[model samples]
Target: MSAFLRSRLLWPVVILIGLVALNVAFTDHFLRIQVKDGHLYGSLIDILRFGTPLILVSLGMTLVIATKGIDLSVGSIVAIAGALACVQISDLDDQNSVSGVLIAVGITLVLSLALGAWNGFLVAGVGIQPIIATLILMVSGRGLAQLIADGQIITINSSPYKLIGGGYWLTLPFSIFIVVALVALTAFLTRRLALGMFIEAVGGNAEASRLSGIRSRGVLIVVYTFCALCAGIAGLMISSNVSSADSNYAGLWIELDAILAVVIGGTSLAGGRFSISGTILGALIIQTLTTTIYSIGVPPETTLLFKALVVTIVCLLQSPAFRKRVARKRPRPPVTQTPVPVSDREPVTNR
Candidate 1:
């Protein structure tokens, strides 16, 4: 029981359950799921569906953070990705063609890889600080996306493209499947292979990892690239869902959310260790909170404040130091002197 309580994932799970309970308290059928046209429909399913993109982004962010590095360009990459893919699709003779969509997607992912590689090079090869290196793109990437989008939203009418985000298959959202597959693959690579160890080694201590013959630079490049790829896929989903790409607002501030999710998922921002499951839960928590905000009718002006307060409370709860401090302040059990039998007591001696 103590071990279970001490588990890093405990607080996150508790907070998630608390959020769900809060919803259940105020909203009827919050936990009810029913088959609608052979598709499952409910607030829970909606939370998972709508939160898919954030989950994917946060998943990638997990590895990058695990390496003690931050990628500020993910949101920009998302915007650029959607802008580029939509631009390509809009120019296609058959926008609905599966092959055309595939080509566009391939192009978008490849470009995203290159962008990730560039970030890796800046941080690893150029020896620039991770923040400044990624920030270069963070600040300028939207402008580049705007340029690709011609300073306007690019909308498309493509059924195949729509399937990437809004389509349902086997009575479930396709986005959920994408996230599942990616999460599985990431888990495999990190847990079942040496990749996870290398990332941890590098993040734990770069100099020591290098001394131990781990190529820190290469690992950095790979993680950043992978993170960009995730953002690119999320970009496709975001654009496909709306069938439009708005460069300015497509993925605005998503990086912040991804970072928050990572932190909330039991991953330290200082890096070294990470939990993908925690990240997923964190994303869900945020999504659930968003849903709760609407269901509970939080005033529009104070919604952000409310969200911030809840998140702050959760973070504090998750902090070991904070927990220890609180524990210290708790009143400990009173101590009572044990009564000894007269036979066991020594006789009093007085001089």
Candidate 2:
């Protein structure tokens, strides 16, 4: 039982189960699902809806962390993308026009890609620390967003744009669907192409990986680019949801949240390994914790404190020292031995 509990899969599974149990205990209708306007309605649905964007960002974060890197600019990239998209749409008479929306999306994508490449170049080519390189954008990305929006929120009245963030399909939020599909696609590509192994190798030892013919620089570039793209998608979802883009609020502090999710999901901050499934579970845990707080009528002012405590607890639990202490606290099984006469008889026979 101790061995089983210590398995890599154990903590994540336990946490997931604990969250589910908490929901069931706290909410009268935690798992109760109902059809409303041909769509599902329930707390479970809400969890997925709120969790999608975080999941997306954390997915990219997992990769970056795997390579012993961090992308602080992800949150800023999100703002930039949303700001650009909203600015483009703001020029149109009707924000709902398909052509205008497409153009905005294209522009956002391009800008995000470029920004990602810039970060990659600094980190990979110029050998800048990932944190410092991304910090440059983290500081300026919001300013750029404000500049694009002319220091004002850019409002749009477009259904297509709304659909990206707020629309529904099969009774579930479209954002949730997008997140699920992306997760599946990413998992497949990484696992099928053996990219996971390669990524792990790069993260585990860059110098060794390079000597072994792996293109570490190229890998970093791709990882940064992917992180930016994820941020871009998150921006689109968030901007679309409000029908307006506010650079200030679009993705403020999201980089922190993504990093937390990745860490809580069992990915090491020191890098070298990752778990997509674990990251997803970590996102869910965060969303659920938020929901739990709101549902229980916790004061808004205390929410931050609660979150801080939770994070601290999770981090401590992941520590080897804590695990060792816990192991020491467990009762040891009594040792057993063969009778002395039986042992002597066996020894004589052998001789």
Number of the top lDDT candidate? 1
What TM-score would candidate 2 get against the native?
0.90
**Candidate 1, RMSD to the unseen true structure:** 3.0
Stretches of model 1 off by over 4 angstroms after superposition: 329-351
The residue-level lDDT of candidate 2 at 234 comes to 92
Q: Give the CA lDDT, 0 to 100, for residue 151 in model 2.
A: 93
Question: Each model's number of backbone clashes?
Answer: 0, 1
List the pairs of residues colliding in candidate 1.
none
**Per-residue accuracy of model 1 over 239-261 as CA lDDT, tens digit each:** 99999999999888899889989
TM-score versus the correct structure, for each prediction: 0.94, 0.90
